[model samples]
Target: MILAVGNIKGGVGKTTLAVNLTIALAQQGRDILLVDGDEQRTATTFTELRTEQLGQAGYTAVSLHGAAIRTQVMQLSPKYSDIVIDSGGRDTGSLRAALTVAETLLIPVQPRSFDIWAVDQVAELVKEAREINEGLRAFVILNGADAQGRDNEESAEALSEIEGLEFLPVSIGRRKAFPNAAATGRAVTEQTPKDSKAVEELAALLSAIQ
Candidate 1:
C-alpha cells in the first residue's frame, strides 16, 4: 500500500509522522520505500542521517517532485512492499501529485486552534481526491498533543465535524523522544531503552492503518 503523510498546514508535524511512520513500517520487516515528495526533503535528510550515523540505512529513500511525480511513484510502487510519501506542508503541485498515487492519506494535526482549523481545507481536498481515486481513504490523526490537556480532546471534537476524513483514535503525544529519535536517525520505537508510551502509540497507529 502507498501511504502519504500530508497536509496543507505547515508546522503540524507532517514530516515527523512521515519519517517515523516509514521507520515503524520498515521495522515490521516489510520492504519499504520512503519518498520525499516535499521540496524541503525532510524525509531524505532523515535517511541521510541514518546512513551516516547508523551505517547503511536498510531501505531506499529518494526525492520525487515535479508534475511527473505521480507517474514515477506508480512505476516504482510494484517494486516495494510499501511506499510512504512525505510531502511539503502546503497544497503545492507536488503534494497534489502525491495524492494522485497514494492509497490513503493521513493528516496529522497538532492539538491547537490553528491546527484544528487546518483540517477543514484538507478534508475538502480528500473529498475531491476520492472522486477520481475511489479507493483512497483519509484519516485525521492527532499529533503533538499536550500530554495533559483538554486540547487533545477539543481538537478531536473539532475534527469530528469534518465531513470527508475519518478521525483516528490513536495519537502521538508531544514527546521529546520524537526529536530525539529523529536526531539519531531512528524511530521513537527504535530508540535505545525504548519509550513504552511511544512504542505503544506507534503500534496502535500502524494497526489502525493496516
Candidate 2:
C-alpha cells in the first residue's frame, strides 16, 4: 500500500506523522519504503538520525526528487508492502503526480484558521488525484490538538463541518515528546515506548488506514 502523508500548510506534522507511521508499520514486520518528497528533506534527515542512533550501517531514508516520481512510486509498489510518501507543504506538479498513484492519501491538519483554509485546497487536490486514480482513498486527521481539554473545539468543529470526509478518530496531541523524538531522528514509539500519546495516536491512525 502506498500512503501519501501531506497537507497544504507546513508545520502541521505531516512529516512527523509520516515518519512515525512508517516506523510503526515497519515494527509490525512490514517491508516499508519512506519516500521524502519534500525539498526540505526533513523526513530524510530523520531517517539518517535514526540510522546513527540505532547504529545501523547506513541511512534508511529514501528520496524521489524531480521528475520520474510516478515511475518511482510504481516501481516501489511491488517491492515494498507499505510505502509512505511525505510530501512538501505546498502543492506541486510532482506531488499531484505521486498522489495519482497512491493507494491512500492521509491529510494532516492542525487546529488553526490558516490550517483550516489549507484543508479545503488539500481536499480538492485529493479529489483531483482520485479522478486520475480510481482506487485512491483520502482521509483527514487532526494533529497537534489537546485531546484531554476543550482546546480542540475549533479543530473538532472544522472536522464536523466537513461532511462526507473520513476523519480519523485518533487525534495526535501536542506534546514535548514529539519534538524531542523528531530531533533525534526517531519515531515517538521508539523514543517513548510506554504510555505515550504519540505512539497511541499513530497506532490508531494506522489501524484506521488498514
Give all TM-scores, in the order shown.
0.96, 0.91
Q: What does the lDDT read for residue 132 in candidate 1?
A: 75
| lDDT measured at residue 195 in model 1 versus the true structure, 0 to 100 | 83
**Candidate 1 displacement at residue 106 in angstroms:** 0.5
Model 1 ranges with Cα > 4 A deviation: none
Best by lDDT: 1
Q: Candidate 2: where is the Cα deviation over 4 Å?
A: 57-60, 147-151, 192-195
**Local distance difference test scores for all models:** 0.84, 0.78
lDDT per residue for candidate 1 within 64-124, as digits (tens), equals 8856678888899989999988877764687777777889898899888887887788887
Find the candidate with the highest TM-score and give its number. 1
